[model samples]
Target: MIDRKKIALLICERLLMEQEMLRVNYINTRDSIGFFYIDNLLPVAIATAIAESFPTSSEMKLKKSLKEDKYISAQMDKHSEILEEVLYAFQDPQVVNLIAEICELQDIYPDEKLYAGGLSLMEKNQFLSPHLDNSHDKERQRWRVLNLLYYVTPEWKIEYGGNLEVWPNGLKAPQVTIESKFNRLAVMATHNDSLHSVSKVLVDKNRCCVSNYYFSDEPLKSSDTFHVTSFRGWPQEKIKDLVLRTDNFLRQTLRKFFKKGIVENPHYYKKE
Candidate 1:
């Protein structure tokens, strides 16, 4: 019972209101980035319940650069019922219709497979280095067009970092940071140039989120080349970026041979 219909409607209404708040002059990039403060974004009880469904021991080990909370996807086939609810929210006909109408999206289809879209939680000192998401979907059949992130952490504070940072500029420059507030949804265009990441959480708090990516039959940019999700260290962390670049290069090369890369990232939740 995710109450997807109600949630979708609420989301639509919030977006309509916030649509006016989108400052074209302030957009961090040449492309688009919109944020909506959706009141009652999701049922608090349901979110807490869903978050508790998985045991602490079941949480996935995060990428090693920093401390993190957990990573869980809706249980693969087994949690289809719960998964469907989340997907329905992401694929709500009205949500899709509004996005298509507003963004002028060209051919928005319901993606049945969630890919790397799922839940992420980060705790104190946890940091996700600056990075660019993979330019294409797993099969490379669809262009990764949009990134939808819904934050659910209750009473999250500014000092307790874990904000989403988008670097429309190349990795060499400063980035634009968007705080991940509770009951808020962030939607942004995803192209090869869409560089983004999560800032480190300063305090001992958990930052949890729900994520989804929408893909199109065509590439987001005609000139967009195929690239892996590239990561960079802080501007001062030059050595870290060098190491990460090598890591990205190897992974990208492997992707050329293995369509899904060395091992399929088990980002989606799976049931026992």
Candidate 2:
């Protein structure tokens, strides 16, 4: 297991020290893709331990689609004690409050149910297509305002692919590559235009990440509107792009009528 209190304390101190710069960075990007990151967010030892705690890919659920190809799980009870602790450390009230302050967001809350916020593993050829996350929480009550992705796979490199790509200027323009570097904590604002995706993994090794989302009573931007998770293929894959766009359209249309949808999303952490 891990010491949640100790971890939260460490985070509070570091974020407090960088609060000004972090806020500035986020504000600067608020008009665009809207994101900021911190390298070596936790001690090297803590980061390494978290990575080591990752379960084998086979132990997780595979989600293969035109939108994404990866393994993810919220069934924390089946995982390590260290993982559950580390995952929720970011959920600690003080830590959550500090993050909301840094991002200049108000009335925010952490998702204990961890909807699409848990462990993700991607291997060679897997990728997440450019997309906007589902705007609201499971019940369509809270808006998902921010995404916290902590990459723990040691020695992951940009050249190795599986990097985070942001289309701030849209797909016609080049993407800004944010390496899925080891021990890096990336926080991105999520709304209608926060279009992003994970580049395809090139090497045979797995890219591991601990993910979370913070919800708010309000959308990140005044102009932000509601939408289902929308996806588009990478710029060059025209046929795939057409297919995905159509697919996203159909799903989104369905969501318009069925607010919660006919079938509930089984991706959430189902507490026993």
Candidate 3:
């Protein structure tokens, strides 16, 4: 059995070793959407174990819509113990604090409930449209400050297309593609302008990832405002963009009246 404590220790070590480089990368990109990535985040053997242990897509909950087509689950108990262990490893204090230090962020806290954070798998034809993450936690308390994505799909290629896309300059400009390489961990700032998405999977194999988010008592920027997870179509998809814009507006308006949306978002973990 993989111990989360041991895994977290390894994560902390890696982050410490790469702290300087990570800080520089983040500083370079801080003007647009601050972000950085580290390769070989865990030992190859452990990463492979996690990849092999991922549940089949059919076993996870399918979320298919205009915004995305993927499998996600926060019900950690329903999956392999290692999967749960690895997910929470990012939440470990040492690991979280190291990441916060590298990003120059303060007052950051990990989400224990795993709200909108857990395992995600995308198969061929599956994709997530460009969007900004929800501004706050489920309860409207802490500001969602950072997104942590740890990719474990061994040998996953750039050509296979399940990569993380960041529209730093918005949809009008060319976007940057970060390969979903195995054993690689990518962290990005989440703010009103930090629009990002996942490229559609072109291969038939599953592209799996473990995800987590760190929240802070204050927003990343003083001017940032609260908003729901907003989605938009590609630059060329004019009609779809219009429809999604309307959808975003409606959802934002709904949140104005209801603290939580009409129907609860069933994406978070429910401890039993």
Q: lDDT per residue, candidate 3, 105-176, as tens digits?
A: 877999999999999999999999999999999898999999999999888899999999999999999999
Q: Pick the winner on lDDT between candidates 1 and 2.
A: 2
Candidate 1, run of 10 with poorest lDDT: 21-30
Native-referenced Cα lDDT, model 2? 0.90
Question: How much lDDT does each candidate structure score?
Answer: 0.67, 0.90, 0.94
Cα lDDT, model 3, residue 101: 87
After aligning candidate 3 to the native by TM-score, how far in Å is the CA of 122 from where it should be?
0.3
**Which parts of model 3 have CA positions greater than 4 angstroms off?**
none
Q: How well does candidate 1 score on lDDT at residue 65?
A: 47
Look at candidate 3 and give me any clashing residue pairs: none
> In model 2, where do residues sit more than 4 Å from their true spots?
none
TM-score of each: 0.82, 0.97, 0.99
Best candidate, TM-score = 3
Ten-residue stretch with the least lDDT total in model 3: 98-107
List all candidate RMSDs to the true structure: 3.5, 1.0, 0.6
